[model samples]
Target: MTAGSRHSVSVAGVVVDDQGRALLIQRRDNGHWEAPGGVLELDEDILTGLRREVEEETGLQVTPTALTGVYKNMPRGIVALVFRCRAEAGSLRESDESSAFRWVTAEEVAKLADEAFAIRVQDALAQHLTAPIRQHDGLRILG
Candidate 1:
């Protein structure tokens, strides 16, 4: 870590349950419904970070299935790496960073995610589903 360095690389995932529902977290500070994710410590592989983040934020054991999409945010920036994952263990519960967690259907996620973070969930799903790109204007993401 350095004085001006961001010091972290975050890996987030769209986690699915048995019924093909997405897991969403209600962040304590932001109050947004988002897919489970967090930062990568130095030296950690992206998948390791993604799994670790999902576990920490949702208390659910997850396995990374595939890379969905990667977004490079700017300014107060971050390289947001996303993945497709599935929960294989533990029950849903809030952790230190979140107030609540739930498995919401794909349709429900599109509606429930509080505006700002909703785009990421939508983008991740689009990539997971390998849908066609609507624009290459670049996603302006904010947490």
Candidate 2:
């Protein structure tokens, strides 16, 4: 593939509470509610990127427990690895990347996020032994 056609890898973490509610962030740039994540730095490993992204967006340090799902944005050439994470330290506070944050139930996640994003949180909550792979057009699922 050409340099311009290369795909970018991103990591997202779904921080689940004891009540099974997942943490969602309202992105400062887009105002869309979704899991906390961002593009991985060239030198950073997956686990480090996951922890950094979660902390940067939510001000909470997290330990990833399981790989939840993998999603590819076909139109944007972006592949995201979603993980099930548990909060290990820090408190919830708004960061530069996020305007607001909340712990939401599965039903609330569906209402707050688009199908492309909601599925990630739902899959994380389900905790299947094998992660699901999916494709989308950035906002909706695709075949």
Candidate 3:
């Protein structure tokens, strides 16, 4: 690692309902629609971080069912672990970090999010036996 180089780990949850719609959030800071997630705290476990992030953003208690994808923001040095989650409890409410919320299908996800974010939702929907590892530049997939 370079002297000043650092990396952060983040977690995202694709909370899917029985109707096959995934929960998406419009970020308060960026106005970008994406899955509910955030950076992990140093003292928390991955699953805990995932649940906390999802709840904080969407006001839903989520239980991660399976890991869907692992993504890296190549330019920003942020590694994100995306999981397929089930809503356990709580009602949807707008929060400080999330300005809007919606339950969207696959097609809607593509139109709402950039490729980098869309891929995470797609992977969760797919529910493949194995998780995929992908790299992106925070907006688009890397070649």
lDDT of 3 by residue, 11-50 (tens): 9999999999999999999999999999999999999999
Q: Which lDDT value does model 2 have at 5?
A: 94
Q: Which stretches of candidate 1 lie over 4 Å from their true place?
A: 1-8, 114-116, 126-143
Per-residue lDDT of model 1, residues 4-66, tens digit only? 766345678888666666778899987878888887888888777787888888888888776
Q: Tell me the whole-model lDDT of each prediction, alpha carbons only.
A: 0.70, 0.95, 0.95
Model 2 over residues 1-143: C-alpha lDDT tens digits?
A: 78989999999999999999999999999899999999999999999999999999998999999999999999899999999999999999998899998899888999999999999999999888899999999899998
Clashing pairs in 1: none
Question: Cα-based RMSD of the predictions, in order?
Answer: 4.2, 0.8, 0.9
Lowest summed lDDT across 10 adjacent residues in model 2 is found at 100-109
- Best-to-worst order by TM-score is 2, 3, 1
Residue 13's C-alpha lDDT in candidate 3? Answer: 98
